[model samples]
Structures are given as C-alpha cells and as structure tokens.
Target: MIYRKDRKVLKRVDFGAAKNSLMGVLAALVVYALVIAWGRVYEAFQLETLLVGGAVVVVTAFRLWLVARFDALYGAGPARWRKLFAFGLILHALVWGLLPAWLVWRVGTGFNFFVVILYNVGVTTALGSSWMAGLKVRQFYILLMFLPVIGALFLGGGLREWLLALLVAAYTFYLFRLYRGQYELFWHAVTRERRSGGAERRRELPASTDIQLSLVYRLAHELRTPMNSVMGMMSLLEDTRLDDEQKEYLQVAGQSGKLMITLIDDVLDYSRILTGRITLSPDYFDLRGAMEQILEAFGPMAQAKGLELAAVVDRLLPKRVRGDRDRLMQVLTNLLSNAIKFSERGEVRMDVDFTAEGEHDGVLRVRVSDQGAGMDTDTLKHLFEDQFLDGAVDAFAVRHTGFGLLVCKGLIEAMGGAIGAESVEGEGSTFWFTVRLGMQADMSESSKLSGAMADIQGVVVGAGAGSLACLQEEFEALGSQCQGARDYDHALQALRAGHREQAEFDLLLVDTHGRRELALNLCRNVLEDPSLRPVKLMLMCTIEERGEPTVQRLVDKHGLVTLVRPVHRTGLRIALGRLLGVPRSQPVQDLPTETPEERRRRKLYRLLLVEDNEVNQLVTRGMLSKLGYQVKTVNNAETALALLDQENFDLVLMDCMMPDLDGFAATRDLREREQREQRPRTPVIAITANTAEGAQARCLAAGMDDFLAKPVHLQELETVLRRWLSREDDSAAEEPDSE
Candidate 1:
C-alpha cells in the first residue's frame, strides 16, 4: 500500500521529469540506433554486436513512448500508469548499463573497444544531465548508466584501462554534484507552476496556438478517461442477464453517455476553429442520417415545450453525398439548437434540397425553420457579430448565441459555403446555408426496393404538415403506397377503407406531437380493429409520450413497435422489414454497401487496435473481426510500441486520444522509428470523435495515413479500410542498409 503524501510527491517528480525528458530521451534513442547500425564496425563479433544493439534500440524506444505520455497516464487516484512510467525509466537506465558491459566483455580491449567506452561516457553524462528533475530517480539512472562502464574498464587489465577508468570515475562523481543543483532548480520551477496552476501559467505564455493546442489535448484526455470507463462498464453489463426494466435503464444510460461524449468532442472542435485553422474534409456520408441525428438531439427539448420537431429530405436528393459531414452537422446543430431554444410551441423543421453545379459537383442546401420569436431587422444585421460590445449586451432579437453563430459562419465560409437567414417580427425565423458537395458517379434519386416491402401500403398520421409530407415520402421511397392524414379521424377512416381489401395496409406510422392521451386512444383503436391485426403499428413519440402508462401498456401487451422521435428512413425501413418477417433487402443505390461475397473476400490482414477504452475495444474489434481481420488490441501506448516492434501489422486503427498519451505524438515517434529502421510504412488510421478538418490535418501531420471518426458505421469502416489496404505501398522499397 502507498501513502497519499508519498504518492503526491512522486506525482510531482513524474510530472516534472516527463516535462523535460522527451528530447533527451529521443537523443538517447538516436544514440542507440547509431550504435546498432555501427555493429558492422566489429566485423569479427558482428552477431554479438547486433544482439546487444537490438536490445538497446528496443529499450530506448520503450522509454521514448512512455516518457512522451507519462503525465496523461498519471491520474490522481490510481498509480497504475505512474508505476509503469517509473519502471520504464528504471529499465531504460538498466538496459543502458548492462548492454554496453556485455559489448565490451565480448569485443575485448581493442581500438574500437576503447572507442565504445568513450562513446558510453559521452552519452551517459550527456543524456542523463538533460533529464529535468526527480533527484532519487535521476541519481539512480546516472549510477546504473555509469557503473557498468567503469567496472568493464577496470576488468580490462593493464595500466592504460585503469587510468581511463579512474578519470571516468572522477567525472561521474563531478557530474552528480552538478546534477543535484539542476534537479533543485527544476523542482522549484515545477512547484511554482503547480501552485499557480500550470494551465494558468501556460496561458500567460507567448505562443498562443501552442497553448490552445496543449489545453485542448489535455482537456480531451481528462474527459475521455472517465467517459471511457462509464461506457466500458455499460458494455460489460450488456453481456449479463437483467430484467426488462433494468435492461431498458441500461440502454438509456448507454445512449445518453454516447451523446455526451459527442458533445465533449464538439467542444474540442469548437476550440480548434477559434484558433483560426479551418478546412473542409469531404467524404461520402448519408445526408438523411446526418439530419436525423441533429433532429433527434433537439427533439426532446422541443417536445418538452409541446412543440413538433422534424426533418425532411427532398425525394430528388441522393441518399448519399460527398461532403464534410462534421461541418454540415455542426452547422445544423447550431441552427437547430437555436431553433429549439427560442421556440415555445408549434414546430421546428429542417428541409434539404440540391442545386446541380456540374456533371460531378453540386451545391447542397439546408434550411432550418422555427416558429420562435422572430429576430428584428436590426438584430439580424449583426446576428453573427459579437453581441457583447464594450461589455454591453445590446443585441436582443438574435437567434443563437453570438459565439455559436460566429463559429458556424467561420466553418461554413471555410468550406466555401454561404449562410443567411430571414425572419418576420413576432412570427418565426428560417436560417439557410449552402455548401458545394461532390456527387457520386452516376448518382440517382431512386433506389430499387426489394420484395421485403415492395408494393405494400401504409398510412401516416402526423401532427405537423412538414412531418406528414416527410413520412409519406419516406414510405414511398421504400416502394410502399402511402396515404397521409392530418388528424386521428382521417387516419382511422383511411385505415378502415384500406383494410377492407383484406388488410391492404401493411404498416401504420403515427407521430404523437406531445398528445399522449390522443396517441393512447389511437393505439387502443388499432388493437380493437381486427383488420389492423396483421398491420405493423408503429408510434413515433417523444420521451415524455413514451412514459405514458397507456402507451407503455399498448406497446408491451399488443406488440406495437414504438420508435423515438426523429426516426431516420434507414432505421424505419429495417424495423419494418423485421416486423414483416423478411430480411432488409433495401437497395443502397450509390451507397457503399458491401456484399457478403465481397466482405468475405477481404484479406484477413493483421490489424493493431490501439484504444484506451474497453468499450471502444469491444466496438472496434467486434466490427473488424466480422470483416475477417485478425485484430490485436492494446490499451496503452507503451504496449502498442512493444507490439509494433515485435510483430508486423498491415494496418493500425488507433484512437488518436489515449489514456496516457496524445496518439499524435506516439504516431509521430512511430513514424520516426520506421524511418530510422527503414521498415515498411503500415497505414495508420486515426479513430476520432472530432471530425473537424483542422484535427484531420493534425493527424496527417503526425504521420497517420487516414482517419475514421467515432461512432464509426460499418459501411464507412469498410470503405476506409478498403481504400487504404488496397493501395500499393510507395515506401515499401527500403533504402539499402547504409548506417
């Protein structure tokens, strides 16, 4: 057991040492690499030289990865990463000590052997002095690195070796005296920063971008650690037996946690844009899914106020388009958030359409309309400007918070998109934005519907006109003839008429616009009507509506499929197919849907999954294994380093943020190692929740070949994997071994 006081002191030591050890540690690795390459210098003892040299390289690289991320892995309560970091430092010294002694014992006191002794002295004093603080740890490291060399020299016999050993011994003693002073000064500085708050001091520094970048990564690590734990525990619990109510509670907790994590990532992205680094990351994504996601996020808030929240995509628009999904979602989120915040009743709806620009390119437009207190003309003029002028809040009739509007404006303009809004006083507002997107080759609006729901009939009862039209289009898109109704009476009449022809209607979709009582009556009528028995009864309700006792009873006893508000077409299609007792045979059209034969044909290449969380591990490995890839998952950067050194991997799927280290630095160091050893470059793809373009650039700069955003979908994963794995390696031809 460890005492808290002693642990605190050790944390300080580890933190300080980590701050100043990276460059020195990297220099030590360079020395090791150089020594390994010089193995041919001892031609007679080449194999022995290579053996010890390889050990040096491995130990140095291990130190490099650990020291690079020691602070991140160090938490307040657990000393797990702390102890591991200490062990790495000690091992680094021990390896340096024993390996060189073995080299001299094997090579004898030849000319090059003396040269080896001199090299060891220079490296020991040089690198050891560079280590910042931590008196005991550094002193121990110094002794271990020097003693073996001194002992080996004394064992060399003769007056010449003795004289040189004495001189080295005198220098090591002198070096310790000097190192103590250095440690004292560095420790004081660490204490000072710790007392004042390191971040406060960092912010006061001159380099603005560096300060922001460090803060972003540090905050991300701090938040991600606990979120990972919560989600991991949820995943573990999912495998256990539980009652129906308990399972539902667990499911809700898991989904809420996922949304929270996404919100945290948005915080990071928001900070990045504030740094004035923005770009567009265009890729293939489902537009309908993106819109549905934003609407779902704000649906509950709207429903709480007895308002309707819905999104509609034009039937003429492609299901899949090539654009920057993150920015598009960000823009939509800002608009929808404002819409729901200001709206008290009525409806908030999002609409989408396309404007063709060329054969392969087009402008995608989105509009968010809300029945909120409309902005005045004066407020609309300065809507995106800072509302607080001279510390005075005068901008009244605005839509969203000024900061959010500014961020959205910057991101949209960076993507070559335009944003504007129109409003009428005392009425409502509609904000619209447009961005250029690439059309998939031979893109078409219609998907060939399969026999699962082909030629079927459905009735849609919606509280809002926008929702009514949207649901009908979605039904028709799935090859079902749909009849729309504005109210419950019309829905019942349509059902009665359609069901007269031997249950003509295959499904019924009802949207409960906060009218729990009305929805409950409709469910009872559906159960009582014998003709509607074979028809799939589905209700789209808000969170509050789902809690109504009658609605719960109708769903539990009568086998009604209750869908949460803001349901997407894809999810609805699958649910209907399952209820109808048929496989989901819907066409994806130009969407990247992998067939069974093609999925199986993918080579079972070895994949290294470097994620700090077990839930993420559960998610990623489960997906990759199904795709036939042999996966090896590691939780920390050091273990990942060790594995990469020992085994060959075709590709690496790494969470750019790790528990103890920023994956960017780790990947950067890994790239440097590959170059030093002249090894083949394996594609390293970053798995991140922040899909902002600046973050993508940072990943690439850190030596990652590509990126996959979090909550990764199967189709997207397949596309990313196939693109990288199928490419010819341009760097596979190593340079001839010239040390």
Candidate 2:
C-alpha cells in the first residue's frame, strides 16, 4: 500500500547485491583476459577480446559506482525509475549482448567457448545484482540479454552455432524469470512487514481504549457506591423526626446525589453505545403495561412540573407485542424526560398507533409530543450531534455526553426503526419512532380505560386543536360524552345554550396554554351562572401559570380541579374520576393493617446481600432494614455461597464485581447447586453499580432473577423483594438496631 513511499527507502538490499556482483563480474573478466594472454591467441581475436573485456570491466565498475551514488541520494528523487531502467538496459546490452555478438563474428567457433562463458558471466552477474532488481529494471535487462542470441540465430553460418545460440537465449530468459520471481517475493515480504507494523499499532490503540473505558466504568461504580450510601442514609434520616432545616439539608443532599447518579447513567449509556454493548431482547409484552409503567415513573415528575402526561393508543392495536420492553421503555423514558425537562407549562403526550400488523408481528408508531420550549433550525441541525449537557444547554438538565435524544436514535436504529423530530421554537416538539413487535394472540383486551370515567358529560375549551382532539377522545374512551371547543367564548356560549340542569355538561375542561386570561375569565363567568356553577371545573395551566395569583385563587377559593399542562389520557382519567365522582376500576394501592401472623411472616422473609465494599453493604443493609427486611451481608461470593447452605434466603442481593467469584459466577454456581440438591431455587438479584448495557442481561444469563443497580433506592429494593417473595410471606418487621 505504501509502494510509492517505499521508493524513498534506499534498500540495503540494492547496495549489498550490487557490491557482491561487481566483485564476481570483475573476477570473471580477469579470468577471460588471462586465458587469452596465456594461450598467445590469434592477434586479431586477442585484440578484440582485450578491447571488449576492457570496455566491459570499465562500464561494470562505473555502474557499481553509480549505484552507490544513487543510494546516497535515494531520498532526493533525482534517479527516477525510468532513468534507472534505461541505465540497466544500456549497461547490460554492452556487456552481455554486444561483446558476445562481436566475438561470435570475429573468433567464430574457435573461441565460442570463451564467448559463451563471458556471456554467461555477464548476464548472471547482472541478474544477481539488486540495483537492477526493480520490476521494470529487471524486465529491461532480460530484453537485452536475448538481443545477441536473436542476432546470431539469423546470421550464424553453422547449425551447431545456431543451436548453441538458441540454448544460450533460453538460459538467459530462464535466469531473468528467476530473478523477477525473487524480486516479487522480496516486495511481498516488505509489504507484509509494513502492514503488520500498522496492525500492531492499531491493536495497541484498542487495548489502551479498553483500559480507559474500564477505568471510567470502575470509577463510576466506585463513586456510585458511596453516593448510594449517603443518599440511603439521608432517606433513612428523613423518615426520622427532624426539623425543617435538617429536612431541607437532607433534601438538597438527596437532590445532588440524584443529579450525580443521572450524570453517571448518561456516561455509562454513551459508553455502552460507543463500545457496541447494547443488543435487543425481544419478548411478547403488554403494550399497555409498558406505557402505564412509564407513566407511573414520570407521573410524579410531570405532576411536580404541574404538567399533564398521558398516552393514547390505537383501539385496534394488540394488547401485547414482541419487542425489547426495557429498551423501548428506555427510549420512551428518554423522550418523555427531555420533554419534561424543557417544558415549563404545556402538556407532554405519548401517542401510539398501529402502523402495520400481520399474523405474528406488528409495527407500532410512537410519538412523544410536548408543548415545551422547542428548537430553532440551527439547534435542530446539531440536535443529535455528540456533546455534553450543561446548565442552559439546549434545555438538557444533566452534565453528560450527548443528550438523551442521541441515545434514543441509537436504540431505534438498532431496533430496525427510524426516529425524527419536528419543533417550532416557541411552541413545542414531537419525537416519533416506529418499531416492529411480535403480536400476543392470547392476551386479553386492555382494561386500562374500561369504565375509567362512565356516565360523565364533558366539554374541553380553549385547547389547541391537537390537545382538544386528544382530550375528547380520551373522555369518550372512558364511556363519557365529551365535546371540544376552540376557545373560551365558544365554550361559554355552549354552556349558556344548554342552561337546563339536565342538558348541561357535568364537567368543563379548559386549556390555559395560550388563552390563560380568557380561560380564567370564563371560569369566573361559569361560577356566576347558577346553571353552570354546579359543573365540575378543571382548568389546564402551564407550570408557570399555575403559580400565578389568579390561577391559585381559582383553585383555592373556587374549588376547581387543576390538571397540569401536557395531560395524559390516563392522567385525564384520574382527574376526571376525582372531579365527576366516577369510580376507577383499579384504585391506588392502600396500606392495610397486618395481623400477628402477618407480622411474623414478614419477619421471616430473609434477604442475603452479597457485596465486597463495606460502605455498599452498610448502605444496602440500612436501606433494606428501613423497609423492614432482615438482611445478611457477606463481603465475598464464597461466604455468600456458604451461607446459602446454612440458611434459606428468600432473595440474594449479588454485587456483580468482587474480589473472588463475582456475581455472575456465584449465581451460576448457586443455580447449579440448587438443581443438584433438588432444593427450591432462591432468587438472586444482581445489586451492582455496573450500568453497562449488557450488564443486566449478563446477570440474567447467570441465573439472576432480577437486577438492582448500586445506591439502590428503598422503593426499588422493596419491589424486587415483593416480586420474588410471596406477598403472604411479606410482613412489616421491626427495624433492626443500627450498628
């Protein structure tokens, strides 16, 4: 590949071969001269021989000197390839061709043996030299070697001479081919050496890269271990009686830890994608279930922002579809997260519809649209370019490489899907993607919206066309009759026209996104009208608008239900259920009193925590204890394995990285041992800070029943416990004494 560059390398191969062959050629010429002089050969033949041999020796010596000079100026580019080739041809012709032809004509058969020997020596010496070993130079030398034989073949007087000339010509051709083959072999070796040198450098780069990535991963986990303890301790402290100042301090500490955790997560995610660690695990999962879980995770966040978050799925879509549930959730979470981060007042909505479906598969189009501060053309151009998030940086709230949208793009593409965004700078943005999923034939129809708000009449006013359409559809889906109005005036006129108590709608939904003032005035007018005053009033306002005095007065004094911006279909259902006295199918979980046996059962629920770091162990143990769990921790996997035989653990919290027998190996061993002894398999949860893409899958492959990352929150830990341990076996045990 670097052939052109190699031309600059003055090969030691050339100079060494040139010097050796010069000695051989000169010696051969000396032998020829001595033979002629000693024999007292014919005067003419002797003179001719002396002249030719003298010329040959002088030319050969000069050529050798030239080669030396060329070597010295190899890098100077003065001796072009064509010049070298011409020189080789001319010199070889004089020594090998012309000398032989002249001897054949003057001495005839008498000195033919000497002539043959001289020709052999000249051609052999030239072939042996590396100076003319270049492909082009060697070719020229071969051509010159055959010239004398060709001349003698037509001009020879005898058959023997012609045959001898033919043989010599054949021999010359054979030597040239041999040297050419050798030249090619040598070139190949050189190229191979250069390539291997480059390969070695390339290999070294990835090795160093691997080392650096490993260090970052380890450092992140190490940092998370301590932060987990601090946050967990703070959470425990918050549960205890504390003054407002102490509570605020703990809150600030918790917030800082959460932010740090987010940053760590972003780093790990980018690294995982960069290192090709992510892969899809497709399985049939409830689409509704996935959507609901995301809503649940971000509902509090949306609510905190005083925003509405909801999903609207197509009615004909399959209840369960095949896809990577976790990854899809992650993508949606990232989109929803970005929406919430940038949106201060408007709604964040997720819209899902069936794009295509067959007997065993379906394609779903998902869009996470938000009425937030959108992007300009310039920002959109580089929206997905790799960069770190910073304060006031494109509305990203974390300090990490690339925004979440980049990660979403990678995941969607990996899933054989495409993603894009549409935004108006001051209006909002909508991010959408399409994914192929397997169809669940056996799944029942979804009950998420079944009777969510029955027997209710509602009117949505002053909402954007999209928002108004979504709200009306949601209400109708919940068995309610609803109508949409473009503005507050239209809604007020409709309410007044239906003045009869029975004909009037029971609920009024107002969008305060752009017409907050008009919406407030309408709400006040509704309160004044006796016919409309009884209607349950729910005003949608931006987070910033919700803090305004007028909005607060409307909510506090007028007893109006307030739904935050970007209201979800589910969120709307919940808000409607509260306002219109509609009974929800599945109410929020309520804590019930436990009897003595229940308490005893809970006390018996045991957890074995396997962690190497003392801080992690303490933090984990404390968090578990706060949840009324009985925990036994060991510093290594060996001790954990030993304890499994001594006591039956309901669940094992395995730390993936340890001094000996890491979580993966330990889980595998535990699973094998349980199978051999025919004992009930205990659940092993990987409690690692290793957030690499395939880390959880690795744990699962190693027989882990679940995964919980480091600085495990109390809720996640409790959820893992409840999922693995039977509910009847669950109990609120007495908190263990602090160590």
Candidate 3:
C-alpha cells in the first residue's frame, strides 16, 4: 500500500514501526556482550561457549546493520519497507529469544544458569512491548520470542526447573492480558494527541466538486471494472447447474462481491454527504422486505465469522414506506458491518422503533447493537467527527468504522433525522439513527420525473461546423433552447439578448473554431461580463489550440470545461453535468400519457441491448432472455441505433460509453430522430459501468428513462423490468394501521 498525502496517520504508523528498532538492536548487543563476558569462565565448555558467543556476535552485527538501514528505506515505499521491517523483526526475535535458552540449557544448575534464564525472560519481556505487538499480541515476533523460551523451560526435568517454568508460563499469560490494556491505552493516547494537535489540521476534501470527481474517477476506473467482471461472472454462473458445495462457493463469492460494491458505494456516498450533494431517490419500498434482504445477505457473513446475527422490528414499525430505500439500507448495512467487524463471536442485533406523526408520515429509529469490544468516552465523543479518524480505542477493529459512521450521520441528518452512539468500553456498543419519512406510497402513484430543469438556455458559437448541428440538436432534444452564432460578437449578442429574461443561460459552448485569437478574446469578454458569470462556459478547441499557451491559461485561470474539437455528446454531458449539474428531466405534465396497462401488456417485448464489452452483452442477454423477452445485442450505440430504425423494439438497454457514438449521444440521436419523424419515444434505459457522480443526471438529460450500474443483479434486473416494462405497480402500500 502506498502512503497517500492526506492519510497522515499512515506516516505516524510507519514512524512507530521505524522507531525503537535501534533499542531492539541495543538489547541484542547486550546479549552478545553477556555471551563474551561469561563464555570464557567455563574452561571445560570452551569450544561450545565460543561458538555460542561468536554466533550471538554475528547475529548482533546483522541486527545493527538492519537498525541502521531500516528507517531510511521507509521513504523508498511503504510495502517494501514494511516487508523489510517484518523480516528484520522476525530475525532479531528468533535469534535473541533462543540464545539465552540455549546457553542456559548448555550450563544447567548454576548462578550463570540463572543469569541466562533471566536474559531469556528479559528478551521475552522486550517482545511483549514491541511495535508489532501493539497491532496484535499474537503477532509473528511474539510467537518467535515466547514459544521457544517457554518450551525450553518446561523441557527441564528437575522440580525446581518445573516451578521456574511454571512461573514463566504465568508471566506469559500476564503479558497477553497486559497487552490488551496497552493496546487500548496506545490508541487512546494516539486519539487524544491527534485531537489536541491536529484539531484544525483534519483532512477535508479541498472542494466538494473535486472530491466527488476524484472519488468517481477511482470508483469507475479502479473499482467498478473489476467488480463488473466479478459480479458478472457470478450472475452468469448462477444460471448454470452446480453441486451444493459449488453453490456454496458461488454464494460466498457473490457475497464478497456485494460487500465490495457496498464499500465502493460508501466511498462515493461519503463524498456526496460531505459535499451536501447526495440525493435521496425517495420512492415506494417495502420496509419489511428491505430488512429481510439485508439480514439474508449478511447471514452467511455472520455465520462464517461464527457470530449470531439477529434483528427485532417493533410492532409499530411500518411494513411499507415511501422513502429513499437504498440510502436507508446503506445506513443500516453500514451499522451491521461495523457491529460484525468488532464482534468476535457474540450476536449482532438490530432493533427498530417507529412513531406515527400523522396518517401519512412518521419517524423511524433503528439501533444496531453488538456484543464486542466497545469504545472509551473520549472516542465515543468524537466518533462522527473527522478528528476521530486517527481511530478509536479498538485500533484495527474500529479502523473501518470512522467515515462510515460519519456518512450515516450526514445521511440521517439530511433526511431530517439524527444519528448517535452509546458504548461502555469493555461491554459493547449500540449505533442508532432516526429519520422522519412518509408511510408506504400508494402503489398506483405514477412515475414522476423532477421538473426543475424542464427548460434551460444554451448557445453554440464556433467554427467547428462539424459539431454545431449535433450540439444544437442534442440541446433541443432535451427540451432546452439552443441558438447558434456566426462569430464572437454574435455569440456575445446572443447571450446578452437572453440575459434579462434568462438571468443566466444554463451553458455556453464556445468552439475555438480554428480561430484562436478571436476565440480567446471572446472568452475574455464573456468572463469579464458580470451578467454572464453565472453561465457555465465550455470551451471546444483543436489539439493544438487546447495546448496553446493562451487557451491553457484561460482554462486554468477560469476553471472552464475544455474539450477537444468534435466534442461528443457523452463527454459534453459529463463536463456540463459537473458544472451545471444533472440534466433536468421533463415535467410530469409534459411526459407522454402512456398507460401502465398498455406497457404491462407488451409481454413478448422486443428489447435492444447496446454494449461494447462482449462479456457484458452475453451476461445481460442471457439474464434478460431467461425472463422470456426477445433480445437483440449490438456492440456499440451506432449499431443499436441502426437496428432500431430497421426493426421495432419495445425498449433499449443502452450502455452509456461506446465507440464514436456513446450511449448518451446515441440516445440523443434516437430522440432527435423520433421527434423529427413523429415516432413515439422508445423506453431507453441506460446500463453503464460508469459510477460518475452525475451519471444518472446525464442519462436522464440525454433522454434515458432510467439508469442501472453495471454487473447488474438478477433481482435488480427483474425489478427494473417490471418498473419500466409496464410501469410496474408492485409496491402497493399497506394500511397505515397494519404491522
């Protein structure tokens, strides 16, 4: 693992590893000196004594070298340095721990014998206090240092020897118990020091926008690609035959993938929570069904860990609710994961409470309790605060809890709720959160699109005529007004013309148009105009123009979204989404009046699946075909679009990124064609591997009806099918009085 700049704690941990190693070397030197001073006294054992002394001296020399070069290598890289430190620590422990035992056994029943035994005990004591010991008591060095001496002591036959061995055995037991206290004390002290010293130095993502984008980049590139393969294989394999053992293995693999995806989701959610940009997609959901799914998902995990997992839902808790189901589940799942992680074997249980506020809404409070190592008051006070990231008293156990709990807090508060914790250091902990939400929505409630971005203004100015028509059509297809200008002056005039009525145009696309000097001046004028500051400026330039000094200066100075010439709609939506936010969807009143029964009646649905990855196409096609829908697969957006023109399909499962024509661009093209030809809009659902922050927004902005992350699950696929295929009204609300 590399030591990143923001995680200063890693530096401190490495320092702990690198420090005090010199003293360990010094301890070895003392043993070597003892060997030399006493070896010559026993003449009869002269040869053996010399050999022992020489070996100790040689090992001591090596340790001294290790101590010298050790800390210097940490700067080289963390993983290599960590391995080196472990190798050296194990070497020293094995040598120093066995030397005194070997010497003591070689010369039995004498003061010098007692002296050797004392040295053995002293070295064992040294190991009980080592850096690695702090992380774990049964660490490698502990086993190396303690086992040999303790085994040798018991091997002696005399009663007195047996008694001394028993004493040392008791000492070893004491050391284990002592380490437990020291470990907590170590973290407690660390937590206090960081708070006092670094209260103001906490690492905050520089700007929320940068943070969201950075996390999104990592999720899409680093996390989701591998996960797509993992979950994809898992989903594909599920449709095949398998023995029970094989099924179990597949189940575990699937569970592991689920947990990994949850962790990946948390990273993005935390960023959203931190930036106050996280949206809760409130809809109809079964509270009981969600609870049952969570428990079922975590059952194997708990059973694998030998911990009992249980839950208690209050009689008053509603069985259905209209709320952000995913977020609610995420918060509870986070709590369950933390409880399971901290517990060794005891039960981790969830308890729910509810209080009805009216006929339609009420408060939901959930508590997750664990019989595990808990936190001290100091730690409990700062659990949700950033300063606690130095970690809580449980050290390794609580390491993963820090930001997760913070996200829970942010999410709960955002739902007009609150979250907190209660713990007694040795007993256990209970984490809880509360949210006020409406009871289950009426199943008949029609799907409604948020209408905030129903209409907006955009202007295109560029000599890049190749892209102008595409850009103008894309904007109009999204229900936005877009005007093209002949040049910089005309562009400025177009923007000023819309100024009074628009207050601010949603976006301004400026193409360098191979006229760098004129384009550069237009940018300066637009930026200088106070009235236009609110409008997002997107600069389109050629390869040479993009790198030109003045253009680069303009981009860097103003933080403009710069794209290479012949900008694709997919790239344009992402860039603008980051600046202007998720494309607003059409108002409910503006949507086509398609009846639910009309959609549900199309059972023999012809579906078009567009994806570049062959494996994904196979996996998706197989999964969809299993449900008995006629499926057509294409390698990219262009092929899919060409096919749609030739054959009629009930819906399109469009992958957002592909060759020349990406999903967003393709969807826009199809929509533009449909609008121009007076064809009814086809239901286009975006299937993408990208977890970028505004992905859903971009999809909706491009005219997609819905969105799904890649490596789609069978159950989720089925749900999306029912929801979109016929505008499925599956989640019927229960009577408020029903449990």
Counted clashes in each candidate structure: 1, 11, 0
lDDT of 1 by residue, 40-135 (tens): 444666776677667767766776776666656665333676556567767877876776666667665444444444455555555444455446
The collision pairs in model 3 are none
Q: Which ten residues in a row have the lowest lDDT in candidate 1?
A: 730-739
Cα lDDT computed for each candidate against the true fold = 0.69, 0.69, 0.67
Q: By lDDT, is 1 or 3 better? A: 1
Best by TM-score: 2
- Model 1 spans with C-alpha error above 4 angstroms: 1-276, 296-301, 387-402, 424-426, 445-462, 475-509, 526-539, 542-564, 571-583, 586-739
Residue-level lDDT for 264 in candidate 2: 71
Angstrom error at residue 7, model 3: 13
| Deviation of model 2 at 52, angstroms | 99
| Model 3: how far residue 219 lies from native, Å | 3.0
Instruction: Give candidates' CA RMSD values in order.
Output: 21.3, 31.1, 31.2
